[model samples]
Target: MQRRRLGREWCWIVRGGQSGGAATPAPTEKVIGMSFPAADHGWLGAVIKNAEDEAKAEGLKYVITTAADPNKQTNDIEDLISKKVSAIVMLPIESAAMTPVAKKVKEAGIPLIVVDRELESDDFTALVKGDNTGIGTHAGKYLVDKLGGKGKIVEIIGVPSSVTTMRSDGFREAIKDHPDMQVIVSQSGDFQKEKSLNVMQNILQSQPQIDAVYTHDDEMALGVLQAIKEAKRTDIKVVTGAGGHKDVYKLIKDGDPLMQATFTYSPLMVKDAVKLAADIVGGKTPAEKVTMLEATPITKDNIDKFYDPNANY
Candidate 1:
């Protein structure tokens, strides 16, 4: 018997089988539900596409819901819960806003697999994410080496979440040892390109003689680069980005000194999250509760290894 909750009611679904050679048993049908932020950017678009492909490959009935904001995400999760999916995978829009809904999923006895930005509490059965801190730490190290550990840095951040917090913390921690290194100002780009372009424009107006720029996402980094080019400011020597974007790779391959490096934060992490949910439905327990992928630094020296023209973000 399979136990599932259907709209506040707990019921058992009976399975059919036979005694010795009585009849052939029918295959059990199970569905997996997925919820994620809408495809506002390239990385998220790739994540949504990858999840759909993976779910289909697993041969399971699946439904995917995307939300533009935290409130919509909460409603989507609630709807999925009401449907009593065998398992759920969610990439929350904002961690704090979705924490309560995550708890609800737990109370309803649904196996939850959290991807990317994590909830505030451990209300999930499994977590699959990238090494955000490593990206920041490595980016800081790269700047320290390039700039000789002393420079005026401007930081362009993403939305308010654990991802943003950890990356900021790690960068600060990395540059703490260098007394002369200074972060002049930090502003939120909200991980959007156009917004970041406007923000960078305002920043360029105020801060003169800026040495480098650190953007949380590659999309924002592209905007920052455009702003620098439009302003024709040659003082800024280095600009670093997170998340492996093909455009960034092309720039590096073509020897753009300013847009030199990016760290690997692949959107394909959602594939692992979906696979974990499938494993749970297959009656297998995850050996580890949290699986974190590594963050690798990419630069002109090794651009050939990662530069794929046909690759999706």
Candidate 2:
């Protein structure tokens, strides 16, 4: 039998079949539950797509749900638990608020794999996430070197989570050694294009002499670019996260003056978790605790290497 956390107060159970091969009759059509924050923006949209594709490819019966609100996410988990899936893959909307859900899944004896944003629990079976800190550190170092170790910079942070905290901390650590480099303005853009644009506009108005801007996501970076153009500011440079977007690649390929670089944090890692979960259910031993995916720095010189026109997001 397989059991997992459903949300906050429920447990999901999955009946197991005889172990060992594809000859084992496909494990009696086991169901896997996937819960993630709603696709309020580009990064999450890609995450959902990756999860669905991976589930289909692995031939697992799956139920997928999305919740942007923490309470709603808890409710969704309860519903999934009632339905009793074998395993659950979750990308939490709020870390602390999801702990009860993780505990419930553990109590039910289901495998719980937390993805992307982490929850506050050791009860989970495994975790899959990107190196947010590394992404930020790389961006910081690159900007520092490009500006000759000194400049006025602005930062647009993502939603409040451990992921954002690590990224911001990493960036700060990298640039802390450079006395000439300073972050004049830092604000939360909530990882949305409109909010990023508005924040950028406000920063421009307040600090007209800014030299560089670092946004946590590419969609927000695009908004920063638009704000810069609207204000007719020619002195600032912009960098962003998520290098997979077509527009980001175009900016890098064409050597756009405004957009200098981006960090690669793939949404495809969600797919990896699905595959790993399927393997474990099929009696294959997989990593027990966590899987960390590396992030790459995408610059004008090597942007073409990651470009995929056929990619949906």
Candidate 3:
């Protein structure tokens, strides 16, 4: 495999032509191509690692690419199409930005296995991801119960994608019945801990009495916790997060009042996506066009079930 640095992104060329669109490769020369957004947080970092590890473990020829933005990811997918890989597995940076290229992948006759985020159109062969709306619903219900069905909530959202839209929509839907529950401040943390920390700090200064926080990702939740602790704020009773990070589980296990729960959105789902691509290459058709994984809630009551000391994310 040859690794090349293309500006901010990285592209690994295992075996393929340097230019031109996808072509029909011989059976023995077939390669599975993977394109993902660059690791912006621990969860995404684990996703990238799992995808690469799974592709290698399957004993399949593959090309992997990572991009920091939608435009860069678009280029990565185009390059993969040119490589003429047998199948393409992509975890899009943003839904709309990648949908057009996803259509192109389908036009080139390459089986596409979408992971995590969904494209605008159903162009992919298979999609493997955790239940995004379920995560938000679970988180909202938990916070509602914890705060006695009424609270001023602060929401730290992810980027502009289907994941963000669905999660936010589901959370609002869950809290809609309880008119007392209100979102005092909702801002994009962009799913990064440091960015979340900065955003949480500003929110903390602005909002004097926040009853709870509903963060879209666990890393962002951790950042929110840090901000709350630094400011010594006591009004915020609970902080709920999505994406099961081990650090958040530790807090729940230790009975931290603020760090109560997180929804299960494991990065290991990418492993399934890679395996699906390899399966498609091996002349197997997916049983379902979309594979939705469960998003189980993890709290202190069930912390033992998910608290893995050896886990990566």
Query: How many backbone clashes does every candidate have?
Result: 0, 8, 0
Error of 1 at 145 (Å): 0.7
Candidate 1 stretches greater than 4 Å from native: 1-28
Which lDDT value does model 2 have at 108? 81
Per-residue C-alpha lDDT of model 1 across residues 85-153, encoded as one tens digit per residue:
888899988989999999999999999999999899999999999999998999999999999999999
Model 3: per-residue Cα lDDT over 204-263, one tens digit each: 998889999999999999999999999999998999998999999999999997998899
lDDT for each residue of candidate 2 in 147-183, tens digit (9 for 90 to 100): 8999999999988787888889999999999999998
Poorest 10 consecutive residues of model 2 by lDDT?
15-24
**Residue 251 error for model 2, in Å?**
0.9
- Candidate 3 regions off by >4 Å? 1-28
The 0-to-1 C-alpha lDDT of every candidate, in the order given, reads 0.86, 0.78, 0.87
Question: Superposing all C-alpha atoms, what RMSD in Å does each candidate have to the true structure?
Answer: 8.8, 7.5, 4.5
Worst 10 residues of 1 by lDDT: 16-25
Pick by TM-score: 1 or 3, better one: 3
The C-alpha local distance difference test score for the whole of candidate 2 amounts to: 0.78
